[model samples]
Target: MSGLGDRILGLGLLVLAVAYGWTAQQWPEPFGGAEGVGPETFPTILSVVLVAGSLYLMVKPDPDAQWPLGKTALELLISLVVLVIYAMLLEPLGFVIATTLAVGTLSWRMGARPVRAFLTGLVSAVVVFVLFNYGLDLSLPAGLLEVS
Candidate 1:
C-alpha cells in the first residue's frame, strides 16, 4: 500500500515538474538587458530539481516507509481548518497576528510543544515578512497592524 502510494506521488510530482518547466519556458522575458536572473530562471531550476527528486524517489524508494493514518489525518484536517480561518481573518486580523496564530496552531496540532511552536511560528512569520516585503519587494496587506 505504501509503495503504491509513493509511486503514485512520485508520478504526480514528475508530471507537475514537467508542466511547471514547460510553463516557465513559455513565459515571456520582461526585459532583454543583462541584470539579475529572469523570472523564469528560478521556476525552471525549481522544476528541474523537482523532476530529479521525483525520479530519484521513484527509482530507489524505501520499503519500510509507512504512511501516517488516523491521528495524522485529524491533525492535517485541523491544520487546514486553521489555515482557512487565517485566510478569512487576514484582512481584519492583520498578517503577523493571523500568520502567527495559524502557524502556531498547526505546529501544535502536529505535536510541537506550545512554547516551541509559538516561537517557531513567530520566527517563520518574521522570515516571511522580510522575504516578501524586503527581499522580493512585494506588498502584502497591512490590515490592522499598518506595517505597510
Candidate 2:
C-alpha cells in the first residue's frame, strides 16, 4: 500500500488521457488538404503527453508522495472548482472574462492582493486572447464581446 495512491492516480489519468485523445479524434478534419495543424492537434499532443506521464507514474510512482491537507487541500479544491466554472462559462462570458475571473480567484487564493491579482488576470487574459485570436489566426468565441 506504499504507493497505492500514486498507482490509482496513474490509472485514472491513463484512462482520462485515452478518452481525451479519442474525443479529440472525433472532431471533423479541417476542410482542406491536411497541410497544417487542425482543431485536434493541440489536444492530441496533450493527450500524448498525459499518456506518457501516466505510464511513467504507473511504472515508477513516487513512494514519498503525500496528499495535501487542510488549507492546501482546500486551495486545490478551490482551483479545481474555478477551472470547472471557467470552462462552463467560457462560451457565454467569453474567454477573456472567464479567464480573468478564474485566474484572479486562483491568484487571490495563492496569497496575492485582490486588486493586483485581478489586474494580473486581466492583463494575462487579454494577452492570451490576442495571441490566440490574432497571432495564431484562431478564432475564440467572442461571446458577449462579439461585434455585429
Candidate 3:
C-alpha cells in the first residue's frame, strides 16, 4: 500500500487514537487521592503520540512504498493475530502468561530456538510483571497464578 492507502491507514489510526484518548479521559476519578497519577496516564500519552504519528503519516505518505508479499505478508498477519489474541487473553490468562505466549511465539518465528525463545519470554514476562506491579503500583491480573 502506498500514498492513498497510507493515508487511509493513518486516518483509521487517527480515529482509533481519538477514541482511545477519549475513553482514557472517561475513567472515574480516583477517590481519596494521594497518588500523583492514575491508571489512564500511560494510555493517554500513548494515544496522543499515536494521534501525532497518524497525522504525520496522513500528511506525508510514501508514494513509492510497496506492500509486503508472500512470506512477509504472512508473517505480518501472524504477528497481528498474536497481538489481538494477547489483548483478548490478557485478563483471563494474566499478563505474564499471555505475554510469554505472544513473545515466545514471535521470537520463535524470528528464528530463536523453541526452548530459548520460551525461556526468554518467561523471564521477560516475570520481570515486567514485577516491575509494573510493585515498582509502578500497577495491578496486572494474576489470573491462574493468583495466590489464595
Candidate 4:
C-alpha cells in the first residue's frame, strides 16, 4: 500500500508507452522513402525508454512515496494545465511561442522572477527551434511567425 499510487502511475505510463509506440508506427512513410531516421524514430525511442522506466517503477515501488497536497498539489495541477494548453496552442502559436509561454510559466512557478523566467524561456525556445529546424532539418510549426 505504501506505493499504490506509484504502481498505478507506472501501469498507466506502461499503457501510454504502448499506445504511443503503436501510434508512431502508424505515421506514413516519408515521400522519398525513409532515409536515415524518420519522424517516428525519436518517439519510438522515447516510448521504449518510458516502457523501461514504467516497468522499473512497477517492479520497485518507492517505499517512501508521498502524495502531494495543498500548495504542492495545486502546482502540479497548474503544470498539467500548462502542458495541455501548450500542446493545444503549438500549431496555432508556433513552436517558439507556445514553448516560451509554457517554459516561462513553469519556471515562474518554480520560483524564478517573472522577467527572468520569460527571458529564459524565450532563449531556450529559440535555441531549440533553431536546433530542430536548422541543425536537424526537422521543421516545427512557424505559427504566426510564418513569413507567409
Candidate 5:
C-alpha cells in the first residue's frame, strides 16, 4: 500500500502503451496518399499520451497509493472483464449493443439505478453509433443486426 502499487501499475500501463503504439503503426497506409492523417494517427497520439502519463506515474508515484480491496476491487475487476468482453463482442454483436452493455454495466456499478443506467447507455450508444456511421459517413458493422 505504497508507491510500489503505483510503480507496478505504471509499468504495466507503459507496456500496454508501447504495444498499442506499435500495433497502430502496423496499419497500412490509406488509399489516397499518406498526405492526410491515416487510421493510425489517433491511436498513436493516444498511446503517446498514455506513455507520458505512465512515465509520470512511475517517476513520482503517490507514496501512499493503495490498491483497491474487497468491494472496490471486485467492481474494478468486473469493469475490466466487461471491457474485455465488449471488445470481443463488438464485431459480432455490433457497436451499439456492445457499447450499451459495457456502458450500462459500468454506470450501474457507479451507483446508478439499473433501469436508468441501461436507458442512458442505450441512448448514448445509439447516438454515438448514428453520429459515427451516418453523420461522419464512417460505417459501423451491423453484425447480428445486419440486413440481408
Candidate 6:
C-alpha cells in the first residue's frame, strides 16, 4: 500500500480504538470492582494499546512492507463466511463441531495444512470453550453436544 493508505488505515484504526475506549468508559459497572481494577479495565487497556500501536504505525511505517489488499479482502470474506456459518449452525452442530469447522476453514484459507489446521482448530476451540465456560464462568451455548 502507499504511504497515504497506511496513514489512512492507521488513522481509522486509531479512531476506532478511541471510540472503543470511550464506549468502555461509558459502560455501567455491572460487575463489582475488584481491589483496584474493574471489569472494563482490561478492555480499556487494550484500546489504549491499539491507539498507541496505530499512532506508531502512522508515524514510522515500514517502506518495504507490502499491503496485500486483494489477499486481505479474500481472507476477510472467508472469515466472515466462516463466522456466519458458525453462528447459524451453532445450535444444530454444537459448539465444538461448529467452532472446529470454522477455525479449520479459516486456518486452511490462511495456508495451513489440512490435518494440522484441523487439529489446531479443534484444540483452539476446546481451549477457548474451557477457558470461557469453566475458568471465567461465562455461560456459553452448549449446543447439541451439551459438553458444558
Off by over 4 Å in 1: 20-46, 80-98, 113-116, 135-148
Model 2: lDDT of residue 3: 79
Clashes of each: 0, 0, 0, 0, 0, 0
Please name the candidate that would achieve the greatest TM-score relative to the true structure.
4
Error of 2 at 69 (Å): 1.6
Model 6, 1-148: lDDT tens digits are 5477678778998999999999888866656543355556767999999999899889987767666689797788778888988989987877777888988888898899999898988999899889877877654567777844
Tens digits of lDDT, candidate 5, 9-88 = 89999999999999999988767667445668778999999999999999999997777899999999999999999999
Model 6 pairs whose backbones collide: none
Whole-model alpha-carbon lDDT for candidate 6: 0.81
Per TM-score, what order, best first? 4, 2, 3, 5, 6, 1
Q: Which stretches of candidate 5 lie over 4 Å from their true place?
A: none
Off by over 4 Å in 3: none
- Report RMSD (Å) for each prediction in the order shown: 4.4, 1.3, 1.7, 1.0, 2.0, 4.1
Q: For candidate 2, lDDT tens digit of each residue in 56-142?
A: 999999889999999889889989999999999999999888889999999999999999999999999999999988987667888
Deviation in angstroms for 79 in model 1?
4.0
Kindly give the stretch of ten consecutive residues in candidate 6 with the minimal lDDT sum.
30-39
Model 1 alpha-carbon miss at residue 112, Å: 3.9
lDDT of each: 0.80, 0.90, 0.91, 0.95, 0.88, 0.81
Candidate numbers sorted by lDDT from highest down = 4, 3, 2, 5, 6, 1
Ten-residue stretch with the least lDDT total in model 1? 29-38
Better of 2 and 4 by TM-score: 4
Error of 5 at 66 (Å): 1.1
